[model samples]
Target chain A: MLKFDEGKVLKNMEGALKLRPQINEVIDDVFSRGFSNVCWLGIGGTYASAMQAVVHMKERTELETFYENAAVFLTTGNKRVTKDTFVVISSVTGSTEEVVQAVKKCKEIGAKVLGFIDKADTELASLVDYLISYPLNEQLKFFMVGDRFMYLAGEFAEYDEFYSEMDQHFAKGIVEVEKAADEFGKEFAKKHHEDAIHYFVGAGNQWGATYSYAMCYWEEQHWIKTKSIEAHEFFHGMFEIVERDTPVTIYVTEDTQRALSERVARFIPQICGNYTIIDAKDYDVPGISEKFRGTLSPFILHAVNNRIDVHVEQINRHPMEIRRYYRQLDY
Target chain B: MLKFDEGKVLKNMEGALKLRPQINEVIDDVFSRGFSNVCWLGIGGTYASAMQAVVHMKERTELETFYENAAVFLTTGNKRVTKDTFVVISSVTGSTEEVVQAVKKCKEIGAKVLGFIDKADTELASLVDYLISYPLNEQLKFFMVGDRFMYLAGEFAEYDEFYSEMDQHFAKGIVEVEKAADEFGKEFAKKHHEDAIHYFVGAGNQWGATYSYAMCYWEEQHWIKTKSIEAHEFFHGMFEIVERDTPVTIYVTEDTQRALSERVARFIPQICGNYTIIDAKDYDVPGISEKFRGTLSPFILHAVNNRIDVHVEQINRHPMEIRRYYRQLDY
Candidate 1:
């Protein structure tokens, strides 16, 4: 049976980059398309990647983009699909029931499908007009998720060479990734604060990663609330939720999306006056890949996330129970 | 200046009755074609009504049923609309941007179009081959918003005269609605327990309403964690979150859909022992139409939601704030 794991998937990202030479082609397709709209589609990992990609794309180009809420498919819809739409459809093997269904609809509707598949002779390959394939060898199952992300990030950052450089930089770090995590854990254990709620704020692609890794799964696992939001979006309405007690953590990086996130971070000191700001540019580690490093950056962002949980656990003196309420809603 | 409120709705519910006279026709139309599937599309108030109606239909019929989550267009969706697909396009005026787009696409796909309309010769009416018209007075907004819910519910419950009974029930309850809310507030205040987080759960149509007004908005407004899940789908996972301290309020009714919810409620005691359960069936409010009453049976639910805010404000609790660190993701 195929199973997906968070920690393991994040750690082994190297295998996601055999197609690095084609990075320029994809990036060119993105730039060639300009500030036009895009449709990011996938189930599970692909969905998560699309969120990050769309957010990041918007951050760089200031172009309008939309996310297809996955829940919508099961609820109510039969809207027409358009071929003009740039759909980045990602699947490890390029085959999934929902993804395949979506792909077929897109093809029929004339939407340009940019297929990201891992396996050979996949249906998605024949379906999409443009294709990018990543092999994802076994050891990197732990890392390929990040690897896939870094490849995309490198394209977006417009640094094919810079992206190439990052693969090596990240791999060296992965060798000692555990020691780094342990050391960070030790430091976090001692610096625990009471009643700290983390706000993982970013405007672009990182916003997507922070949301999935930080907000959804992490909070569920640890019972600690982490709100990951687009920084500018935060300013419009959510900033008011800020107060003295709430300690916000901003995940910063040098990627283009940083401008908005940084601006929001700058205002935090003035508004609520206290927040932990980690400049992601200064701290980068990966065995995954460069494109994905930014996407998977939040995994490394556990310095604050872990400590907050450990500290809260130390204080609540209770084990964390991830609560997911799925009660019946009948007539 | 346009604002949509459920209470402001006329609740005349005449459209439902007017449509009832043609119930056999609609039902015949529904079955004769034996269409592959059905699609319902609407926006805002009309959208909510469509949701309620679809859920009601599912509970009343044995035919395979589901809702497509039309994110951009309530009516247009990913499911391929074909000759056999019956498109149920709902628009108060049939002029909403996305609705129009979807209807046009439905025709493009050759699906039979059915419209729930307010005006004769209106855009949606002209677009769909089959037209079901409501009294299109300016006052129909009320029917569009909620009163129709009563009509649909009454029809589902086999109460043919329920709408007129509703006119009487509401006329009576109108005199006491405010007092009821006030009474509800006081009762909530008296037994208000601050020991744990308030968990309000619902599934299906009520679940949609509760999702919009209660969980998403309420949780964000008060910084209290509230989640809603689909009933039957919840059994797959997420049942483990229930605990003794966390009260699970079950909104119950005698409506046909109650079978699933009631079954789930019956199992709750075994799963989470010693939890406070709110079963609206436990209360008595006179003159309320059976289906309407079954629904508003959760009237006290409004006050229960309010009490959560009261407690949150009393605690001065809020989420943290942060500025972005890096904004390097693509736009």
Candidate 2:
């Protein structure tokens, strides 16, 4: 629990959860008034965070949803984007340059823009047609941003029952996450303290979390060498690099594609000497149903991994806030 | 030229080119009729190869094009896939289990399945509604598969002029790739022969080739540590790992988003001690108009990297064909 603030984490998470009703209303309004398609645009970690929700919307609804890098999308105009299209863009800080430009472009196209940010006075809030601003504290930014987006997407896709369940049990879920993190964080750091390359694997909705954690936390924050591969694609090419002592982290979610991760989990231990499997089923959610657990797996796994981030930061003596180049230098 | 058979490469590439007219006819027939949307489904390298074409289609055409992993798609069924949907699937062997399952699922949904394979008698050829089979020699497979897919996608989007120019000048383009590769590959091998981790950066349509080369050739074939990051996403997180001696390869394509790659190209040398830039513009693609070169960048870059692959294979004494786990073990 080094540098961990339990009260702040709970309060920020609760603040995000409280936005559910407002987000649902906004989604309902968009749905009631017909729209052509939905586009999710963000930069870096924000884009990675929206991936699972985009996948969920694509799988569960006929609505055409695109998850794109904001800068790339601005430069390469999507033919599907039009006046009737609805775009949802997110940035923890509403002043991200690429996102600001994206919002401007969306406005020129006359598309309805929904901006998600931490402050209402920022440029994005001024440009977007609607705004959902919340406090994005460092402790809970990833989980809160991911949760809000997924909840909105689910509501738009008419998963009312699932949304209701998430609203009811997520607060309780965090308590379990805190307890589990305190235990797993120290253990993972103790075993994986050396300077080594790590491979993180997940499937289904959890793939986004796997990717985000690998890039945003491990590589960006800690300067660790890591590669995040989807479990479905693991055996194809990436697995060839695995040795008996390779460090591999497997996140097994409760989704339908759990079988895919299980397949990898079964195979890795046979060939890899150091492999850790973190299953969402190990964490207890007091009121959440088994079927609904799959939908909320990304949020839960993210919370668990966030703790690992804290441990890795402490063990390495590398403050998570330190950046060698990201915001320090001009590209 | 270290281990390359120029004549065989030319012959196989020419054979793949011969299928152009047939591919055009099929695409024309499909477009002339109608389809709900387009789905590009593949696994591993095949999936990575199709990324650029999918992006091109999404940007240029009104049709909703989806690029997805075959196994993931099979497990999480897309709501947009229906009887009217047009699904394109590819595999060199045509016997890939996941691809076969995908073809079955597409057939079950009554979708029009387009299968690209190396042989006509394969299972994928039998299951698909339409089949395009050609000789998939080691040298020509990457360029041919990518070219064929991009060509079909471009034709559907009505890029007749661009396609016509590519047809007239691609053979000449290969010759230029040969010259550049002969020069760059030897120099690269001489300096970086020792085993070390490499970072590959690419933007626009060339991102697929970058990912494919890093995973398939570098990681899988040579057991080298490599991470392929999109140029747009490089500054976001992965760039933090760069140091004075980091080995980085930047692929600068001649596309609309050339500036994105150039941005990274500009920054790397200032911060990193070792960086190699393989710009598509360096090769003189004879008879190919400047406007059309962007579309053919991936093919040219692939040919250039193919030489590097040969050099890496020679320097490391690692046969590109050797497998540690891929196809050597069952999952």
Candidate 3:
């Protein structure tokens, strides 16, 4: 595998699994303390991740769950976010200015904040009331918090089966998915690395992944021009921009909204000659129940897309970490 | 005003105001009949408009309001959208497949639907329990419905003053705004109509305007490529793709989230030399109160951006209503 480090991957996945007890404890403490509502607060990519969790919470529970981007929350306060609100936030750098400001505001209002941070020695890490160190598994960690809370609230009945299977197969299955997707990723990167612009589409839980991958990875990391359309919104106006030779990719999930992107997948072939479909259903994750496959498609996608990112970076000769303006100058 | 029709604009705006009595009657009847929650449903541009209303509702009221794109709602089905749910939807064509399907599902579940349609004879008009013909005032009509509901529930104290002012000045003031913005719009279109791609940034209530203008107008109507980034999310990744000569346009509003876009505006000039700032504050609605200005920024932006659309259409020599794929071809 190109640029692949199996040991580090396994270590991180194993570490995420090891945090189950800690995650459960945090959820238990938050429940015991009693919260009026749950507010998922994050900045940029983290906000997209929070949106996925909020969508899940809305589907499975009657719990009052609100998802807000950190900057919006900081500027325009939510009346629902009060002292009794349980706020969940995540940061890879753990020092994103907006997230730090939002966390400070939450602390000022006495809201209980559970923060997932990669770095343990950052401003956001110190601001959070309950901290969980999730160096690699951001979405997995978020699902653990949300699903455990829903289990206690009687909204998630399959919590036991889901996590039990996750413990057994998730780490290894994900690595296998990465290796499986490596070849296709290389071909895709080789063909479309220098395309004028890439149009990406995804639906259901993968919409956040679609948005984040396009903005955070393609635009920021790879310095590529791209537009991400929600599978549901693709037909509304975006389809008009498609041509026979356009570089298009539609990500299909095994979720209930599968048909939404499947609709795009079917239509794209009719109009676009150059297209790619990254269906989560194509990936095999042993030991995970069929009923719970939809819930984990995003993580499946993460594995598949990580391979593509590696190949794209290598082919383009552009380091994913290079940035022209971000964190280099004061705005 | 190149290609502007003042008469048609005034008639449409006035017509929307004239529907106030009918709109109030529908809301009064819905309130008397009782409802559990409000669900704003639409596809694409209409969905974006509903988002602006949802943001306003979230800011001002504690009502259980859910905004869902019609396609997603049609497939996944919200458990919260029940027989007692007040479903609000808008469609220009009123024959959008997914919206009609979602409306049918809502009907099957006995949900009362209030639909805003431009055409009175479309299929959606026959399906909705309550219909309001809003040919041009989609956002205004949505605000009327939401603000009226909030007023009836005692959540909006300034509702009386707000509507009274809207009735007096909204139509004419919006025309003035359009006229005021025509020269700037003409110059902007002349300068950037042929740019490779336009990057649009907006926040708060005006974010919907930003999104719709970029996708519905730029991409769909004009066949031009564009990427609309939320103001709060701009610094996240989109800013990295912006060069000194990148054609970036940031939409600013007078809402609580003003600071969010303002921050983007402040930063864009520092990096991108070829950037346009379309500030809603620059275009004033004479009779509207200062306190209510933020609430009407989307409409103000509509007036401003409409001028830009006219010029872009004229400059690009593309008919705004011409579509290669939309209604002409069946997927």
Candidate 4:
């Protein structure tokens, strides 16, 4: 529980849960108005977070969903993004230049823009056709947006039930994650602190969480060298880099592609002695249905890993919020 | 040129060029049959190679094009892929298991499957509705496939002219690449040989080449750790890892998104002293049109970097073909 604020975490989760009705209203309004496809646009962590939702929608529904980089989308216009497209833009700061420009482009194309902003009076909130403002927490931001996408993709009733369950036992999930952190954080950090490179592998929806942790948290915040490889692609070429003590974290989620992670699990110990498997199935979430466990694994895994972030910060003596170049100098 | 095979290179180039007309025929035939959308499917390096083609098609035409991971697609089906979808499958050996499975799935869904196979008789070649057999050079494979995609996406006459030009001076481009490799390969290897991690930054079409070289060649072949960060995304988070002596390579291509690369070009030298700029514009590719330069940069860049592979092989004493786990293990 070092450097942890339990009250803040609870408040943030509650605030995110409060946005459920507003998000549902936006989804309903957009569908009723008629849209050709859906685009989830953001930069950096925001883009990474939306990707989990994209994978969920792609698997469960026939809705056309695109997870695009805000800046890259500007330079290379997508042919599928038309006047009738519905765009969901996430920006906690509400001033990310790339997301703002993307919102402008979407507006110019006559697409409906929904903004998930942390501040109500910000530029992004003003620009979007519909806005949902909540407390700024990366995990909560993704969960809310992902929930909305799954709902709009025709899993509304199922997701509503799941969300209701989460509402009742949200505090328990947090407490369980914190307990895991207290048990594993120090050991994980001690084992990996001096490692020059870390390979983060995950399959299915957990791939986004794995990527976000590697790029947004480790590489961006701690300036550590990390490569986020999907479990399926890990065998193709990346496995060659493995050594006896190569630092590897395998995130196992409950999904159709869990076998993919299991394959890596079986193979890694054969080559890498420093590998650690963080299986979401290890966690006990009260009131969550078995059907919804796979869908909610990313959120749970992210919370568990957030503890590792705190421990890593303490062990490495590198403040998690410090960045060497991001927003420090003009590029 | 150290380890250069001029005759074999010319032969390979000729063989790849020979497939152009056949590839075009397939494209024409597929369009004539009337398809709803395009699905470019592959895994690892193959998937990375198809990404540039997907980006080109997305930008130039109104066609809905998807660049999907073969194994991931098998587990989580794409909503856009339907009976009317024209799925393009690339497998050099004609027997990548994931791709074969994906082809089967596409066929099951009644989609027309096109296979780009290296051999005439293989499981994947047999399974696909149409097959184009050719020598498997990564650059050539992508170029041919990308050209086919562009043609199908409504750039027939322009791409046709570009192909004609490439066919004439194809040898010249290879020769120019060999010369650059001869000049710069040893130096690049010497500077980067001791580095533990490499940051490969590229934008536009060059992003695919950068990712391929990083994942397939460096990590797979040499067992050297590398992070392939898109130029636009570099500013977002990846730049935080930069140090004064961090090894970095910026791939600059002549495309609409050249500015994105240029942004990194300007920033990298300021933050990292051991940085190299491999600009495609630096090479003199005789007889290739200015309009066609961006389209062909991947090929030129791949050839130039092949020398780096040779030098890295020599300095690190790691045979490019040696794999610790890939294909050797049953994962």
lDDT of 1 by residue, B162-271 (tens): 55565455433532443434444444433433423444456544555454333233334543434344443234233444555445555544444454456567777765
Give candidate 1 regions above 4 Å deviation.
A1-11, A20-38, A42-47, A60-65, A78-163, A166-170, A173-182, A189-202, A223-248, A255-275, A284-331, B1-242, B247-331
CA error at residue A140 for candidate 3, angstroms: 0.2
For B13-64, candidate 4 gives per-residue lDDT tens digits of 7787887777777778887888888888888988887787776555576777
Reference-based TM-score of each model: 0.47, 0.94, 0.97, 0.96
Rank the candidate models, highest TM-score first: 3, 4, 2, 1
The candidate scoring highest on lDDT is 3
Point out the worst 10-residue segment of candidate 2 chain A by lDDT. Answer: A137-146
Cα distance off (Å), candidate 3, residue B171: 1.0
Q: Which candidate achieves the best TM-score against the true structure?
A: 3
Local accuracy of candidate 2 as per-residue lDDT tens digits, B165-214:
65676765686688667868877866766646888999888887788888
Residue-wise lDDT of candidate 2 within A34-113, one digit each (tens)? 78887777878878766776765544566677777887877777778889887877677787888899889999989998
Every candidate's DockQ is 0.05, 0.76, 0.74, 0.76
How far does residue A191 in candidate 3 sit from its true spot (Å)?
A: 1.1
Clashing residue pairs, backbone N/CA/C < 3 A, model 2: A244-A273
Report the CA-based lDDT of candidate 2 relative to the real structure.
0.77
For model 3, the stretches where C-alpha displacement exceeds 4 angstroms are B32-34
Q: Point out where model 2 deviates above 4 Å.
A: A137-160, B137-160
Q: How close is candidate 1 to the true structure, as a TM-score?
A: 0.47
CA lDDT of each prediction against the hidden true structure:
0.48, 0.77, 0.88, 0.80
